[model samples]
Target: MSFLKKLKEKISKQTDTVTEKFKHGLEKTRNSFADKVNDLVYRYRKVDEDFFEELEEILIGADVGVSTVMELIDQLKEEVQRRNIQDPKEVQAVISEKLVGIYKGDSEFSNEINMQEDQLTVVLFVGVNGVGKTTTIGKLAHKFKSEGKSVLLAAGDTFRAGAIEQLEVWGDRVGVEVIKQGSGSDPAAVMYDAVQAAKARKVDVLLCDTAGRLQNKVNLMKELEKVKRVIEREVPGAPHEVLLVIDATTGQNGLSQAKTFREATNVTGIVLTKLDGTAKGGIVLAIRNEMDVPVKFVGLGEQMDDLQQFDPEQYVYGLFANLVETEEV
Candidate 1:
């Protein structure tokens, strides 16, 4: 089949049993929001003033951000005028295409695991609670191991209850060894241990799981900086990547999280969770457009395979594909 069709089928196969979890969350997104837009479409046969007003609200509400939404609406308006469009469904298609144009215009994002020079590559995951940080680590480790690499996990999320065990759970699921220090333990101490172990054992990748801080941004930044410093002291440029994981379902709040984390630590990339959800999926653009961070991964389901590298072209197209679906609620 076609590339897009093949990808959709693959995602369908992987998420078939649990796509509802994806559908349920996405169906509730406030952007290009369903309630009013669907209602407006059913009411009017063609483009009108009220539709644009409501469409603007839907995009803004879904966390597309005001500026981006304005640009999107303006483009849609131009399309309406140029094509002399009259159908609501057709207009929806136009909206989707414009969104696809946002991030995937010319560049394609690489999702492959990159190797380092002398030692194994190390990635440190950072994010707030409930952003799927631990789960992403497990999935990423599985991804690397699938590529014929020795992987080890360091559970440094010692502050939260069951955080270390949670990482262990992933390690167990993936059949990889987990180096962990217990809860209330020094996070830096855990990283030091993980670093030293990875060096001697010569694992391909070392993933450090950190606690999700509900505290102030400075405190969080300081805590992450300490972890990096400790790892560097032990392994020297040890943590090769600092990835910030965000829940896409959280919408614009995800962008704010990126900003804070970027300031706190050098967030080299982002992993967007809950992409299957209906949160407009526009936050991906907002992240790239505003913060200039390349989105590395996107979580589409609960399974390990659900977390895949963020392909701007495929994702940009997929986000709007639902708009063209014949099925209607």
Candidate 2:
């Protein structure tokens, strides 16, 4: 009846490959974060004030966000008093349980992409440059294509030099057509063209790429507003998903970018890239708890198929795979 046991049973029903990916991708965080917790538990056999303080520091070190760490620590204290727990080892499962709880909270948000039942599904990708925005789009296009859905790419990043060609390269690699205009052309115009082409070709999904310039917030907001306006006018309820891509390696700076984009446009979901490359995977919790926006997908590895839909259970399992497998019910 332990929380870890329940998690093991729940994860057992899912695909083993996915679980393994989570385990492997989270190795860095586990080695840095979970391993430290294991050491803390070993060094302090009894749960006490000092023990909780050290644990708080560990959670904060993992980039769990200061406020969230405080909240989690307070909950742990209440749970300890309520259950009269004395062993530090017994707190591991509670930590895992609380992490999943914090991510889910009271909301019933679904992480799935919002695809149209019988019409073209438009997904707009937004992020500052060098955050792997283009690559995420390519990977997503590949994902949709692998699902037997006809996909199209709209090169709306006309402001950046070679942005169109970059998207085209991905288009060719994925064997999908790219709708683009010449460099320095208006991005809104490119979107207009892409929308028309997607409708004409009747593609199942259209992934639109936009300029990632954050040099001026006013310009960024104006440009995104214009692009969104064109899409809405062309196809009602279009641009169904505006996914903000962030590099996990950047840590807190990534969260800052999320806030900026959320202000400029309505970011429906987040696509966290380079998750395997960071030791602070705890940013996932900070984003969800603080921003209230769901992380729809995460880049677990460098492989094309490593971009996966976010699952809180699998994520916690990944963070404590070693301990979860060895713990007794």
Top TM-score model: 2
After superposing candidate 2, which stretches have Cα over 4 Å from the reference?
A: none
Q: Over the stretch 45-73, how does candidate 1's per-residue lDDT look in tens digits?
A: 67888889988887776677887778788
- The TM-score that candidate 1 achieves is 0.80
Candidate 1 lDDT for residue 265: 88
Candidate 2 per-residue lDDT, tens place, 1-329, comes to: 77877897899999999999999998999999999999999899799999999999999888888888998999999998899999999898889999999999888866899999989999999999988998999999999999999999999999887889988888988899999989999999999999999999888999999999888999999999999999999999989999999999898899899999999999999999999999999999999988999999999998989999999999999998888767753
- Clashing residue pairs found in predicted model 1: 26-277, 26-278, 31-62, 32-58
TM-score of each: 0.80, 0.98
Best by lDDT: 2
* Predicted structure 2: clash tally: 0
Q: How much is 1 displaced in model 2, in angstroms?
A: 3.6
